[model samples]
Target: MLAGFEKSTGKPPEELSLPWKGMPDLKTGEETVEIFRSWRPHSMLFNLPNGNSMALSHEDECPLHPRSIVVVDDVYCIFLGMLLENTCDLRSHYGLSRQVTEAMVVVEAYKVLRDRTPYPPDQVVRDLQGKFAFVLFDARANTLFIARDRDGCIPLQWRMARDGSLVCSDDPNVIAEACGNCCTFFPPGCIYMSGDHPLNKIRAITWEDDEGNISSVLFQVDLFTRLRSIPRTDSSANWAGVTTVDGE
Candidate 1:
């Protein structure tokens, strides 16, 4: 994964800080937020179930493209970048007041995809037109939905820590420092959903412009506890053929 990441990002793995061979004392959550404070002033950390954690932060440097977090009905979302289309439409569709933030729109969208739509998660993601990346955690359901824009307009990366915690961030340096060569870029145009619900799945999707080709790949943790990607094709008869895992 690191080799592929370096090849695509043009950043050598050796340049990253020494990898943490074992777990550091990050369970308290404060230590993890501090790592991000070096880059942004505003930071918040959420301690997730199963010893997992999420840290979000952003600066006031770009007012036009602001970062936002919204919690509604036990669903928490952190969004970066703008939803150029369907922001208002989604707000109206969900009967959300105009005062609601963009993060709320994302939460409603996820709910629709998870509960209402028969379309695959990747299909809903592919229809979205914007430069954005978001992480939504449904605390009540113990599920997580993460996605990046099709063009890779916003940065996002993830890696499994030595302690088996999943770490994700927009800053590659932070991810590199924590997981070193183990880190990899969260593939563009991919949606990763993991939950106890039978309908949830982890899918990494790709599309080619020249031929309008589309493909889907499933991500699974093998018996050896290694993340592996298996290529798959779309089947109308079994749209939800992929498997899902609980929050690791």
Candidate 2:
């Protein structure tokens, strides 16, 4: 993956760029027939957040037939993109004043695409990712998410695409250009958000697993917790707190 993130971070993958919107299909003069039988060198990308991409292979091994290793670099990706292009050019050419600089560490590391409201109402502004990543999209929560690298070396691949898209890739020519058929691999850090496409809603989450499920949590205690902390105007409150109408 970008020459093992440029040999474990020496830095140099076209100075880097995946800010979010998609771009990285570095194909030049024909590549890939690799089912075996010599011919290697590859990488293709796109993940401006919604463009959705990934396909990088670099492995050609054979140390006296070490169990006939067929293309030994099965994308165990640990991308650092060259220590993030030398810490984003040393925080923009040594200006680093700090507000968590490096442009707010690349915008608070994609701040849940702007404070999380969940899925495509322009998914936090149509996604757009950065930092040692993996991204797959069906767009506007059309399902199939596969983001990556919580620690896992970037190996990725996911399924669904007989005529239904919801893919993820690390080289089957990006599943033949977004699901013409190639789905399956993204086992990295793990971010697979799938209801299982084709207009997915398949319920069965059956009440359980709540550890960040704030139950729409609200906590206030000063200035009435900054003005009655929560209440988006269904407008009804009595007991001397005021505001109660309905024929009052």
**Top-TM-score candidate index:** 1
Predicted structure with the largest lDDT when compared to the true one: 1
Candidate RMSDs in order = 10.8, 20.9
TM-score of each: 0.62, 0.21
Clashing pairs in 1: none
- Displacement of the residue 90 alpha carbon in candidate 2, Å: 9.7
Tens digit of per-residue lDDT, candidate 2, span 1-248: 21111111111111111111132432211122222112233433323233233334445312321111011112122222112335654445435443333223333333343244332222211222333343323333322333343333434443332222233334444335533322234333323333311111111111212653211111111212122212233222211112110000
Candidate 2 ranges with C-alpha deviation above 4 Å: 1-108, 116-133, 136-160, 163-165, 173-248
Error of 1 at 49 (Å): 3.7
Cα lDDT listed for each candidate: 0.52, 0.27
Q: Could you tally the backbone clashes for each prediction? A: 0, 14
Query: Candidate 1's residue-wise lDDT over 97-186, tens digit each?
Result: 988777787787777766843445553354356788777777666666777766667766664433334556676665555444444555
